[model samples]
Target: MVGAFEQALLALMIFVIMLGMGASLTPRDFYLALKRPYGLAIGVVSQYGFMPFIGFLLITFLPLPSAVAVGVLIMSCMPGGTTSNIFTYFSKGNLALSVLMTVTSTVFGVLLIPILLLIYANALDLEIPRENIIATLVLLLVPVAIGMGLRRLNANGGAVTEFMGSLLAVFFIAFILISWVPRNWEFLLTTTPATYVASIALGVCGIAIGYAFARVLRLHPRNARTVALETGIQNGPLAIAIVAFTFSGTEAQSYMAVPALYSLFIVIVATCVTFIFRRANTAAEQKMPDGLL
Candidate 1:
């Protein structure tokens, strides 16, 4: 069970993360979405469509406890993490499209997450209360809007907001390392290999399906890569927040494990993906002549 101090810290971390997300955005980002709606549309479809399906299959096949399955499903339902933008950059992807997709998906997530979670929970015969889901979603959107407003009101606020966002990211990692991991050491140690496999499969399949879907839609290579990263790198902190808020005591602790593990696993997978893309990009660049460049 999470203590009062830990619960308060978790809430603060989530707010800061969302604020950073909003700080990163501007009216211009939304305008960009309108101008290149197809990329955004395709990204949203791939994120919501493929990831949830992947989570469902994993939960059905794997022997995850009920709480862990719901946790995984919630993580799958979330928007692309800010981390995906970094991975997209490393992978030589469409950075602009990546940002746009992240912003668009997050905005859409305020509504979609609750709805998708309800649907998946019902299908899986899980009993997550609808009210709790709605409450969590509302809590999430409030801070995001405030951050967006801060940026919109003052041009310079974006820089500060971004800095806060980055700082919050570090704090989140540290909190997990120093607090969550140690507190849940027993569960972590006892975690099944299948749980690890399921988490890995979710990330890998999300990237692959997103890329294939983009290719099928005739998107450019860079755009395809961007979609793949966005689809695979989910908003894990948001998942953690939802679990913490909606459940309590041992239930919260059990549910927290999936997103916690996923948060670490996806980063490693994304790094590998980034390395492969970087090497391929470098080779392609070498093959091209200077004159063409």
Candidate 2:
């Protein structure tokens, strides 16, 4: 179980992280992206649709405890992480589309997340505090709104804040390794392999499925890559914040297992995926416009 101090620290970090995500955008950015909504729509499908289903499948097949299962499902169902934008940039994917996808999924998540969790959680006969989670998700948006306000008021400040958020997303992995791993060493040692499998496979499968989904839609390779990254790279910090804020007791630690492990592994997973994407970046693809339909 997470100590009170850890829970408080988690909340504070997430607040700053979300604030950074908000700084990366303005009302104008959304207005521009809305002009071309097709790719944006695909991202939403990938996020709320494909990713959650992926989670459901993992838990269905894996023999996870109820608390651990909850963690996996929640982690899988998250919106595109701002971390995706950083990887998308390095992967030579469409950064604009990536950012738009992140924003759109987050905005829509307020409505879709509870519904999806309710449906899937019921299937597994697990209990979720839907109201608490809903409240947590809504509260998270406050930092984002503040971040957006910062952007609208001053472009330079927004850029800096955006950088900090993305940077923190990376450093958070180290935080987990340092703070969480040591404390949970015994639990990790005794954890079932299925848990680890579920954790790793969630990202791996989401990326593969997302890439395939984009190709089937006949999207441009750059856009396809963007969709794949956006789909696989879920908002880990948000999921962690949700779990930390909504649950208490031994259940809190169990609920945190997948999200914490996923957060640590995703950086490694995305790094490898980004290398492959870089290899696939053809000259023609580079010359092609970054704008997505």
Q: Residue pairs in steric clash, candidate 1?
A: none
Stretches of candidate 1 exceeding 4 Å from the true structure: 282-293
Cα lDDT tens digits for candidate 2, 60-99: 9889998999998899778998899999999988888889
Q: Estimate each model's TM-score.
A: 0.92, 0.97
The TM-score obtained by model 2 is 0.97
Worst 10 residues of 2 by lDDT: 284-293
| Backbone-clash count (model 1) | 0
Residue 157's C-alpha lDDT in candidate 1?
83
Badly placed stretches (over 4 Å) of model 2 are 287-290
